[model samples]
Target: MNGQVMKKLLKIAVVAAFSFQSAIVSAKLEMIDRVVALVDSDVVLASELVRRTNSVLQQIKSRNQTAPPLDKLQAQILDRLILESLQMQMAKRVGVRVSDTELDSAITRIAEQNNLSIEQFRKSIEEEGTSWAIFREDIRAEIMVSRARGGSVSRRIKISDKEVDNLLVQIDNEGLSRVQYSLGHILLPLPEGASPEEITKIRDKADKLIRELRNGANFQEYAITYSAGQNALNGGNLGWRNASQLPTLFSGSVKNMKVGDISEPLRSGSGLHILHLIDSKGGFETHSVIQTHVRHILISPNAITDEKAAFDKLKLIRQRIVDGEKFEDLAIEFSDDKGSGSLGGDLKWSDPGTFVPEFTKAMEALAVNEMSEPVKTEFGWHLIEVLGRRNQDQTEEKKRERAYRILHNRKFEEEAQIWLQELKEQAYIKIIDEN
Candidate 1:
């Protein structure tokens, strides 16, 4: 669907069925397409369905995966197109749009993600058969669908504090403090009738064994040769055990020991034991995640202020931010997203999922204290800044945040299907049989 010819073909067909009359078009041109399906006030043309089906087939082939029967794939893709058409209609009804600035930013992100310059990405797309013009419209459609989906779905999915608290309780009861360890043990046992002198001999032997293991002596080899523990035959290899499952004495000692470190003699009533720190897992350190502290000046276009004016205003705001004007003051004075604007545009410390995809991407790419050029979204333009960032420990704040997300996601999937089903049930949809 990407080459120059298809690009021209698709561009023509995509634009209101290229909106030319088929009789007139056929009179002048050779190619003709028919409606495959009729959506509420729109049609899914045969050309568009074939184009998408081929794209899916090409993707499957590229991945070396077996393609499904053509009939089945077409049905699925046709259903998908029907849904998109429904959503696009909704978008038009609501005045949701993909502005040129927003489209350009999205394309830039796509190019960057592919590790290609804009020119190269364009060249690659055209070479592959999709014209840049058609490609842009496709991206615009994608963005619109996303906005539509979010607008429809987000309101239905809400996570309560009570839900988060209950989940955290469940997680806590399931042992949040446990860490697992794989260890090697060597036991120098005391003879049953051993005197104090005999105990000293075992302790010294344990100390000596630890020194040897520390200085590159093979711990498993030593365990098999000199240890009297039950696992001594298996090179004293204590396969993975949680902290609570470990020997009372070895449990506390292993927590502070680094992997590969052989402990000093852990004197249990039965013997003087030596432990090797083989490996550990599932500690709090693993919960570290980066969170961004970000803020922005948001401005929206209205009848009085066009998209250009909105964008131009944000550009000046960003430049002032770069040149040392306080972002908070400017945001308070100028931002149209008044709720956050009153707070100096401070969205506060947040994960990337806090905002729309475009905002998330722009925020993720900024450094601490750095400002971004105006970025576009459905809401309009924004001049964003990364106030600071941190690899925060997963404290209570993080746990609840994650719990909220888990509950929200679980409900979202269930609700989104219901929402879409309702959309279908409520919509005017008719499929034209090829037969």
Candidate 2:
């Protein structure tokens, strides 16, 4: 009987052990099921979504403002997640990849900006209830998006002489000195994962700072305390730049205004720019000239299969030009350059320094209606033609306009927005929740 009792006791102990193991297994399975959404190959856990929502709420709270309604906030978060997923997908499609080292360096820069050691910064984020893994992923996603967008936009964008000429007209009207203001800026950047609402709140704060500056507050003091940009320590002074050097958007606003003037808040890639005109000199005399329309045929060895083949192909095209086909017609048929190919390879001109040296030299050497032999540049080979040329004098109004043109052309945010929207429309996107 005692032996029978010992066997029964052993069985009971075994059953208890099995029950404990089963509980652990069940708990893990439950955690896995808590994923609220899946973006392509990535999963967004319910916990993670909630954590981010709470983070945004905290930001709102810190500013002593009420959070948006729960439903509204949730919708915004969902949209943001979808956009981020789409950006990541597009980045991969474009073959733009960020390395681990790049991610680490970005994080280090952030930490340094915040006046913390890397370890300390990591700890601080952890204390705020965010893991290093999430932060690194966020940084990587942003960098990838920026790089891909920049590549796509830059391919199609150009600075034309007509644009420069228009700018010159504005400068003449303003009668402002063609001065290069030595300027510096200190920026206080927002977090990479900040939501639209958060961005708006940040902008409001920036506007307030701008107001204080306009009221005679010290620029450097405010920058040191609140600016998020790397140049914040230097008081937001961008070093010496001509009127042409200032972006077109800011140029017009600052034109006709004297030194010591601070601009109204202007938005940029990272954040708002509140420019202070440090000093101006050399509103020098200027000249204007009618731009020429030129067409060319480009032969690219890089695009061809072999060096001999590329050279031979270019030689054939050169022979055809020598034999008497219009260069424009040939450019339309065979040039590798896409920007001017459809327009008969016509590059409208104003300034001299715009084209590559070889292309420029070829153009400068040619008379109107003259076609050159195959000329080589880093991009490949080219046959250039000068369609026409005319001249005019430069004026202050022209200078101001030119400055404005430069600003308008370099508005990175506008370009980025247009590119992103195009990518989104072209992509295959399905929101599981909506479906």
Candidate 3:
């Protein structure tokens, strides 16, 4: 690991421990809790590899599947850990930390999704031999990694309004709605400008993988172990993609596949490829419009004001509103939004996508009359309250949104692969353990 990267990770660790002072617990270090791999400046501990490998083994066992060799599984898990470590480091540098409140909310949502209460969720994890703190930290790490990837990849992606319009036109040409495929992909990447002999070798490897997949080996497991795709660490998930949004090379094979069918080895410019159609749905999925009656007090940081100052100011403002002070009056007095400040911060009824992504996400998460904690956006910091919500007919708007999503997902997949490959190539990674 590089010294600079090590310092950065240590700094983040200290800050995180300080931030969660009360919750921080000291665990007695085991003898084997030493470095297994160096990822730039970060170290992947032997203990971490064992813990993650055990978790993966449990998952496979629960599925009634034969376990892969422990050494092989650990190698793949170690690579994933390295990628995660890199992302966490990047997230800290990019100011993409997930807050405790946000993490708690996410946990609550997870419990609800599983039809369990918070207590039940806790009990379940404990029954499975994992502590609540460990589960929470795992969840937090996942969110940080997701945010880091988005922050890093989003900047590289460009989706023009014209492109959206063009997609809408194409959607119209095909039909309003089409089949969406849930795809898992594996790419046996060839070296750049590879000789014909090297290409043949890679193709033969792809052929071997196909036979294994056909013989009941898990696609995701093998993808993680051997594939060199951008989403290899995510088990090569391309996610649920509309037919038009799929890579042109994949479209032909995918369109012919039934649910649960896996594609034969297909050669593309980048590599030899295999795809599994996990499921399919939505030839004509209906759409509806949900509008929020929202309002917010903005606090833009200026030359004298920093992000922390803006956040602190909004926190106090939010507290005052929670203490029964009039939100509109507070907005009128302190909001930096000139137009909305005069209007008592009343954004009124607005359809989704009208506001920035951060603002939209915060607003969507709020209950009617519930004010959010200080949230940051490109404009600055904000304290948002959802006044009301209503569902209305918005066929055209929904169509446009669907079109934009398809295009965005397609672009994101392409860019994410390139970005991840670049990160791997540029990073100073060394695997200490031999497989």
Candidate 4:
């Protein structure tokens, strides 16, 4: 494989390792004896499952106002473990591999996402009782599986003009509900106590980048390599995002652009920005009030030892709301969820199946402006309030277009899975069980 592909694969493997850490275990007689489950070429250990279980539980406790029963959690863990084994087998059959560079880049991306330096991110993981080596291996495996899937399935999928036309017709008939847009952005960041020369340099850089893009130097590549933003790794994808999802400064520019157009660089408080329109659909003249928001919360379990302690803390907060205190105020004061709690735990309007089951259940249970009791999920205790709900009557055209896209994805996955299974059946796999 090419170096780039190898790098990507390695990074993916690290992610996989982190994802499946709970399924592998090492022996520690002083602590607990490690047990092996199904051992393929990739070993599944009891310690790995335990680690994963704890990580999942921690996540659940963070967002949920309540916890799921242990039996349910165990089943979920086993399902994940089985899926991992299948993917790993597929990777071996396909001869998918990851390189060290890819692993480093993936780690870098993770660090950036957490707003941490690479060293700091590593330290954090290490502190959580995980070995970085194991993490990297997991990520590498994931990368291999992804490459295998893409190589096997993407080559066969074609986007035809007829398909596009049909999709458009359906969208037109249905009255497009979710607007998709193509956007390009140039950011101009201000320096502290910047002189004229510094500001000029910043603008000059943006201008140069714009010139290159206009001249047909791939914008996505430039964004990936040069953009000093979180979305850089995604090649500035921004992905079918809503206008309201953008910053106020860029949203207006995005709203005005047609497909395949570029915007003039505009200055914002943080920096200067230039946007290019890739494509857009739906939201022709109006938008539905409801938007689906998906969120994940991380809770530190150092404070609360048992489920009761966690539940009790959340329950107390709920009691305060029953006593007539504002939900937002309670969220700000007591909720351990930092991301949404600051906003009074408002997830904004979202579509169905957008949130974790527990969070969705709470939201669905509440009427408009109605507050829910402390509900527990894996995240932790949650008190949800439904802000509002709206059901837009979609046209037949929209339905067909949506159906086609969904079907295409489903088919791709199905084909990819079959291909991987065949590859696995042909490959040489050896299992070394140490436990």
Instruction: Give the candidate number with the greatest TM-score.
Output: 3
| Candidate 1 clashes between residue pairs 3 or more apart in a chain or in different chains | 2-129, 2-130, 3-129, 3-130, 12-18
Clashes of each: 5, 44, 1, 54
| Descending-TM-score candidate ranking | 3, 1, 2, 4
The regions of model 3 sitting more than 4 angstroms off are 1-30, 191-197, 211-221, 228-240, 245-248, 266-270, 285-393
> Please, what's the RMSD in Å of model 1?
22.2
Off by over 4 Å in 4: 1-31, 34-36, 39-41, 153-160, 175-410, 413-435
Task: List ranges where model 2 is wrong by over 4 Å.
Answer: 1-48, 168-411
Question: TM-score for each prediction?
Answer: 0.48, 0.42, 0.67, 0.38
TM-score of candidate 2 to 2 decimals = 0.42
What's the distance in Å from true for residue 375, model 3? 26
Residue-level lDDT of model 3, residues 302-379, one tens digit each, is 999998999999998988887889999999999999899989999989988999999999999999988898888999
Assess each prediction's global lDDT (C-alpha) against the native: 0.77, 0.66, 0.81, 0.61
Q: What C-alpha RMSD separates each model from the true structure?
A: 22.2, 15.3, 11.5, 24.0
lDDT of 4 by residue, 1-435 (tens): 545335544655665565566456542213232334443444455567778767656654554423345655554455346556667666677777788998899879989999999889889888877788887887887788677667667777665657656645644554433565667554445544568898888888888888877787766555544554334334456667555345545655776777776677777544556677887766653323344333222222345456677666767766777788787776666667887778866666576777789878777766676767666777766666666677654455455555456445634643444454444455444432554
Leading candidate by lDDT? 3
